[model samples]
Structure formats: C-alpha cells, structure tokens
Target: MPREVRELAEDPTGVDAGTQDAVLLFVGGPLDGRVEIREARHGEPLPTVTHVHLHGGPKVVHRYDLTPLGPGVGVYHLRPQQVVRDRSVAD
Candidate 1:
C-alpha cells in the first residue's frame, strides 16, 4: 500500500474542501502506527486519524510536525466534513 495508489482510490480532494483539509491537518505526521479514519469526533485523546502520512494515500510527500499542546484539560476538537469506512486490521 502506497500513498500515490491510495490517493487515487480515495481522493481526499474529491471530498468537501474543508473536510479534506481538516483530515490532512489532523493526521499529518509520523504516527506510532496507522489508525482507522472515523468521521465522528471523540472525547478520547487518540481517535482514529486520516491524514497524508498515516493513511495510504497521496500525502507521503508532505511534512508535518506534531507538537504537544500541553498536559492540561482543554477542549480538543476534530470537525470532519465527511466520514469514510476504515480498512485496517490488527495483527
């Protein structure tokens, strides 16, 4: 599975402009592992993410830095324009 190939299959660009951008920004970085893409927002810190690097799509070329906001109780929100089924399995 590669970014280029996946991108063709699931074109984030085809999705709503705002949603596509949010998805890319939300999950664009060196992730510990690949997680599924969930549309609905969650209260948990780690919800499934869909972005350029994590998802097998045409986003491998982009570079992003993950900065910890801080160790505090704050509202972290994720607003998605659309939701897609995830195709990941645990080993």
Candidate 2:
C-alpha cells in the first residue's frame, strides 16, 4: 500500500515555471529488508530508477534513497529528474 505521501517538492533546474511539481510516494514491499517507494504524479509515471550498488556500498544512491523513517515506515526518495518511472505494485 502507498502511504505517507501527499506531494513532493524538488527543483534542481531553479526555474519557476509557475507550475507546482508534486509527486506521490508508493512505499511498500520488503526487498532485502528495505522499503521501496516509487514516484507518481497525477496517476502517471515519472522516471526510471536502477539500484546500482546492490552490494554493501553506500546507503543512498543517485536516483533512489532508501532510508528508514520510522519503526515500520521507510522513506524512499528519487532525484530531481530520473527515478523509478512507471513502476507500481498491487496491494
């Protein structure tokens, strides 16, 4: 199930196009003891994300950042442009 998300605020281009770019988060699934959250906006996909360092490297990456938010809730993040696009799981 997707929860704990209402809107996303990220701007890397530093351009005010007079449009509010918001994103929804879909956090679920237990993949190697880490929660996965995908980005969605207006029920559409954003960008594609690939977990590069699957091994024991850094905790966060460029496209995605898997970090624990709470005891059972984990916070997943995407960069400004590219992330996990068109990816979702059924509840």
Highest lDDT: which candidate? 2
The candidate 2 region of ten consecutive residues with least summed lDDT is 36-45
Model 1 per-residue lDDT tens digits across residues 1-91: 6666434534434654223212212342344333333242432244333335446664443333333343211122333334444669654
Query: What local lDDT does model 2 show for residue 60?
Result: 42
Clash pairs, candidate 2, are 47-85, 48-83, 49-83
In order, what lDDT does every prediction score? 0.35, 0.41
- Model 2, 1-91: lDDT tens digits are 8778645445454433233233334333222344333322332233444444455774444454445443223445553444555458654
The TM-scores of all predictions, comma-separated, are 0.17, 0.22
**TM-score, prediction 2:** 0.22
Query: Candidate 1: misplaced stretches above 4 Å?
Result: 1-52, 60-71, 82-91
